[model samples]
Each structure stands twice: as structure tokens, then as C-alpha cells.
Target: MKEKLGVVPFWQGYDRKEVLKIARIAEDLGYESIWIPEAWGYEQFQLLTEIAKETTRIKLATGIANVFSRSAGLLAMSTATLDEISEGRVILGLGTSGKNVVENFHGTPYRKPLTRLRETIGICKTLWRGERLTPEQSTLAELRHFKLAMTPVRADIPIYVASLQPKAVRELGRIADGWVPTFWPYEHFNEGLEWIAEGARDAGRDPSEIELAPFLGVVPIEDVDFARSALKPMISFYIGGMGTYYHDMFCRFGFTENADLVRDLYVAGNKQESIAAVSDDLVDAIAICGSPEHCRERLGEWRANGMGHGLVGLSPGATADSVEFILKAVAPA
Candidate 1:
């Protein structure tokens, strides 16, 4: 594996205080960036602010801040502020988070997700350039006339779109500075590459304009079975309980029976069975687990198939010391 890795330490069983420590260690180990996720836990930018205060070299990304939770103006302002504070080390990774999270958690309707994402991107860029929002772009008549007061540190802050569906995935070719995807099956993954190229051609943009930066889950323990055990529950949760997207994706990847069983068992409240339903083969296709050597080999496989930067999140049950060891063992060579 080459040196194209980024660290994301917001997985289950991770100690909150240890996140900054890991970020510092990763920067020292020559990792490219650190991506902080915002779901139900700590706010993404605040955590990145702390990391920005602690480390100086590595880039900082939002991992994903969804479009629905915050208005486009707010997202632009906060990201601009963070970009200034971080001294131009910000990558605003945007996504349409699941319907449950947007509606149930944020109390916002999840209609027209792709449209909101496209609108949010356009608005954020417009504000970043110190330009007023146009009448057609704003939902409110009053919203169109105001521009950001302070100049952003960088006008073109990199925006990575983390989209799963084909329609939004196609949009990535036209607009994204980087593509942040997870759970794209290793085999037959070229299906997505074709879509990206098709999108670029449609938009009269070269596909090379978009960077390939996908997420890959990893369990760095030496025991393959133990690592699989740790990874299965998370996979099951995403495939079954999280939403229909993951299940539909796996089905699209030719795992219809497996995906169906996992969802059915999970919906029936048989979590253990749902976890058990996740096969080791599927895990291998989607993640890198097992011994350090095995992880290194699996990473090489993905890179061989066109994975660029590796934004790896260790599986649950990783400790500070264990993470340090894993980082060293699997550090890009």
C-alpha cells in the first residue's frame, strides 16, 4: 500500500478524549488528513477545531456534515470560520444523511435530498466567494441580498460529496472536489466508476476533476475471526437498522439474499442473528480486517482497483494503545 491514508477515530468503544491524541499521532505518522464525523455525538466542526488547535500539518475534513441539519448559509459561515481558524486546512465533506437522522433527529423533512445537496453546494460556494445569493437560489425573498461579512481564508474550500445513490453519485462528477463513499463492494465496483465518468461527460467536465476518496472500515486486530465479530454488528446495523440504502446497495452489488436475510432478522429484533447473518465474504468485500499483514494486503487490492485516499475508521473496541499499534502496522508504505 502507498502512503494515501487518512484517520477517522469516531467509531464505537473509542474514548472521546483519545481522538485528538490519535489525530496528533496520525499527523506524525505521515497520514494525509483527519476526517471528523457528525452524527449523534460531538459537533463535527467543534471537534475539528480542537484538532486544529492541537495539530498543524494534516488537513481536516468534516467526514460528512449533512445538508438538511443546517441551512446552507450557516454551513458556509461556520466552515469559513473554521477554515480561517484552521488556516486553510478545511475540507467540507457534504452528504445527504439518512432520512431517519434528518427527520427523526434534526426534526427536518428529508425531501429532495439531492436537490438540497446541490443547492447547498452552490450556496456555500457563492457565499464563500463573498457574492450575494441570487433571488432564484434563495427560498426567502430576503435571503438573496446578504453576503458573508468576513472574507474566507480560501474561496474554494474543497467539498467532498458522500453520496450512495446513483443520481447523486452522478452529481459528484460535476461538482465534487472529492468523492467520499463507503460500503461500495470491492468486486464489480467499476459500476460506480462508469457512473462517475458518465456524469462528468454529461456535465462537460473531465472525470479527473473529481478526486477518489472513499471510506473503508477496518478492524486491525490480529485475530481475523475476532475482528470480523467486532465488524459484523456495525455492518448489520448499517445494512439492516440504519436505513434501506445500505441494504439496497448490497442488493445492487449482487448480495440480494444476504442483504434480505440481514434486514429481516434485524427488523425482527434479533440483533445477534442479524449480526450473524453478515457473512465474512461480504465483510472482506467491503472492509479491511484481520492481521496487520492481511489489512495491508486488502488495502493494496482496493488501491489496485482505483481507490485513492483511504479514510479508514477502525472497528469498535479499539483502544488508544491498540490504535497506535494499528497505525504503525498498517501505515502507508
Candidate 2:
């Protein structure tokens, strides 16, 4: 059986043309989607629009749009316009990025994230519904009372929320049509599903209604050691200094010792040490690496274990040949 897979290219440090090539390749290979992430790098809308022009069938999404950066109504407008351009193949992946990006980079305070996200989705839907966004509804983002100037071509576009914390996951279950989780090892995937189910039950929504799409880092290199080493920096970065939120989440997922050591090494300016400290076991559990056969086997396991939709994050060292190999190996039938 073919598993659902989406390509998530490294947005920064790569040539724009190459990224577009990967998207076209994935579409040609029958991958389900291509997700573009916005993280202190390129804007997603322009890039996604450009990508839409290149690919014919694969769905496009904002691996995530930071809720703190743009108002909810604007997000709705952007999604509507992109959906129109993509001919209704756009998925709005929304999230509250770490405090560092929100406060430091965007100059916006990250406040009441759970409520903010819930309200943001509601506001977006309200605008899409062509209803008047009243001041009473505007209390969250200070949204003004107004209706969309034009009717959206597809008002019911899917909205997926990127979440890790239990509360956020629960809320995602309640409101989002899908969930995008990072650092979710296969062993702990069910834990997140349960949290989402709890919220679905609370809201009287079917748990199956929400799609489970996890971001997976894949390193398909001939040398096992090289693949593991290549992924260590990224794994260590997220488990260490990305933010206390992610660090705490990793600890809760039963990586307390590794998380602590990685964070300590990273903070002490021992960046190399931090990378070295990321054990092969942790990396293997969270990512797929090694030979092509091994990576294909893991992809099968992921599909069997409820990976309905997967966002594949390629290693920085991935070449054109390696990416094409992955596309064929994991292509959805």
C-alpha cells in the first residue's frame, strides 16, 4: 500500500530553483502534498504561489504560519487568495511559534497562545463565512467589524494546527481539521492522538475527523554513521535551544536525560558536544536514516502505525538523486 507523504524542503540555505525542482519531483512521484514552512526565512505565500505554478496536482500548505505574526482576518484573506490561485489545493497550517520568534523577531508578545489560536481559527472561519466580524468577536485580535470584500472561492479550506503540548493538542482536536506535530517519535504518537481524541470527545467531534500529519526528518545516506551524524545538529538544536517549550515537551516524552545534557552542552557553548551527545537511539527513534531499504522499511512502519499524512523533512546533505530516491521509495500509491 502506498503511504501518504508530503515533501517539506529546507526553506533556507538552498537555491530557490532547487526547492521548486523538488516540489515538481514530488508531485510527479505522486506524493500527496508539499509543505512550505516560514521561519525567519522566506515568506510562504509568494513561494507557495510560485510552487503552484510549477506543480500540477500536489497539495500546498504553509507547514505553518505563525499566528502571532499576522492577524486572523488577514490570514483568512491570504488563505482565500492562495486557494483561489491554487485552484483550492491550499491548506492553512497555523501555529504559535516559539516565544523567541514571536517576541524577538516579530516584535509581538506571545500571550494566551491556546486562546489566541482558538480565536484565530474562529475569526478566520467567520471571515470566510462572509459574516460580519463584529467588535465583540474582535476582542481577541482587535478585529474590526467588517465582511470580506469578496466571496472566497473555497470558504471551507482545511485548517491544520501545529501543536505539541497536550493542551494545545486537545484544542487542535476541537477546532482544527488536522494536526501537525514535530519531534513526535513513533513510540509516543499514540499519546498525542489520545490528547486530540479527548478534545474531540469534549467538543462532540469525531476524532477521525482530524488528520494526523507528523513532520519526520529523513536521512537516506549509504553510510549509517554519516546519516546519524548529519541529523544530530538539527535534533540537538530542537531538543536543546529551540525553546524551553520544546525542551520541556521532549522531556515529557521520556527524553529528560538526553534533553538536559543536550541543552546544557548547547548553553555552555559546546555546540559540537551537544551534537555528539545526541545518541543514535534517540535519532533513530525520531527520524528515518541509514540505507534506502532501511528508510523504506521505517516508512512502512510509520504508515502502519497511523501516520495518515506525513511531512517529510529532508536532511541538509540530501542531493537530487537522494531526494528522487526517497520520493519513489515513499510515494503514495
Candidate 3:
């Protein structure tokens, strides 16, 4: 399939005015969707609402909002509200965030990610259908016997699940309208797709109906050295220090064999060494960092691997003009 291309805005340093300008420009650029993220600094829903009002046709999505942070019912209400504001162009992306963010930042327990995700999705679907919710003893218990006072403008809002593990990916296929993921290498896409298909069959849902959208880190530059250098910080941060021993994505990717060495280098502030520890093959496999033509080949591989949407995360110092250039160069003609 010829897939849609999208952009993810780094809403951190921008004021409201700047964000609106970016959103408007993205819409004008013929982009299919714009993903807004929530973290400690910014509110995802508020930013999305503003962007929805500013743009005419582009879709708006929460790149991901943590399932543990809010009550499932409240999340459904927020999703419905955003959908109404965007006139049914909202995609609710939900995830079980890592322990560092969920526990330390949000002051919520990070436990039973699979079960929590299942319950949260179930409750959100129920609430979206205008069903009265009575909280059970699952991860979702903050809102009990609550129903939205106002009626939703639409009940067909798409719910995308942000997942990294096989289990969650499969569960997402079973229940979610779409999948959002990170750190997925093009070569391993089928490893995930197979699990997702299993879940879809288990739930009696068509696997093809589930949209697969994965974020790709791209630095479109002819200067290979510069592009490689720019990706170092992110590589070191995620591969070295993003999570605890029990739940690190990097370790699962085989970087754990050098765990102490990697962490020590990262924590002692030798970021370059930490980046060096990340294998060149792994980095090249996962990220699309090269000239425009090279990026097109990489994107083609991802598309062949079952991805339906490319969510590009442009690196720092990468201008919107550069992004637009790359998009036009690689987008299907």
C-alpha cells in the first residue's frame, strides 16, 4: 500500500503561537497527520486542541498519553472532547510508559503493563460508547461509576496503542484501531506483525484493519558525520539510561551484554563513548540517517515490512524546510 506520511512536533521550547504556526504549516504541506506528545513539561491534549483549531484538514494525535496517569474514563472524555474539537480527526494514542516517567515523574505505580493496558483500553472504549463505568480492581480504578455528563460528538474516534514489546503489540492488534511504536528496525517488522496478527485472529478482528505507525528518526543531511553526531545523544540516552534493569528496551535489543560499561560511560558523562558502544549496524538498521535518496530506500524497506504510516521525528537543527524537502523526495509519487 502507498502509505501516508506524518510529522511529530517537538512542542517543548515553542510557545503557543509558534506551535500554531508549525501546525498550520504542516497542514499546508499535505501531511496526513501531526503527532503531539505529553511529558513532564507540556500537556498533550491542550496542545492538540489548539492545533486542531488552527489546522483545517490535517489529523491530530497524541503521539502517546500514558495510561497510568489519568483515569480511563477521564481519558475517554478527553479523547471525545478533542475529537469534537477536531471534528472527528483525533487519534487517541495510549501507552504504558516506562517506570522512570510513570513512577518518578507522574507519581503513579508502574505495574502489570499488559493488564493495565488491556483494562484501560476496555474502559476507554466503554466510556466512549457512552456506557456508565464502574471501576474494577484493575490498574484503572480512579474513576468509578462515572459517565460523561455531556454526550460525545462521535464514538468512532481511532485509538492507537503505543507499544514496544511483543505482548503489547499483539494486544493492540486485538483491541486497538492502530499501533504506534519506537525503536523498531525495518528488518524486524515482521517479528512484530506476526504477533499482531495472532492477536487479531484471537479477537476475530481483521489484521489489515489495524494501522501500523512507527516513528523514524531522520536527519536529512549529505554530511554523514554531522548526521551521525547529531543522533549520538538520543542513542546514548535511550540505550544507556532510559529505564531500570528490568524494563530497558536497549538491553532487550542486546546492548545489555555491555550494560555496566554502557551505563558507567553514560552516567560518568562520557556521552560519546556511550554512543560508540551502540553498534553502527544497530543504529543504521533502526534510524534513517543519510542523504535523501538513501532515506527513500530505507523507507521502502519499512513499507515492505508492513508499516502503513511513517511518523518522522526530525532531529535538532533540522529545519522544517529540510523536512519538507526530504518528505517530497521520498513520498510516493
Q: What is the lDDT of candidate 3?
A: 0.76
Against the true structure, candidate 3 reaches a TM-score of 0.89
- Residue 318's lDDT within candidate 2 is 54
CA lDDT of each prediction against the hidden true structure: 0.85, 0.84, 0.76
Tens digit of per-residue lDDT, candidate 3, span 1-333: 455878776644535565566567667767788888777877989888988878879889888888889877678888999888888898888988888888888898888878888888888777777887764635445656776787787766788898887788889889999888777766777877888899999999999999889887776668866776666667677656766532265566655665556677888898888777665655676677788788777788888888898897755444555556655655553
Runs in model 3 lying further than 4 Å from the true structure: 11-15, 134-145, 244-264, 316-332
Query: Which portions of model 1 miss their true places by more than 4 Å?
Result: 11-14, 138-142
Of 1 and 3, the candidate ahead on TM-score is 1
Q: Give the winner by lDDT: 1 or 3.
A: 1
Q: Return model 1's CA RMSD, one decimal.
A: 1.9
Candidate 3 weakest lDDT stretch, 10 residues: 242-251
Tell me the tens digit of each residue's lDDT in model 2 across 4-97.
Answer: 8898877556556778888888988888898888888789988999998887788999988988999887898899988888888999999988
User: For candidate 2, what is the lDDT?
Assistant: 0.84
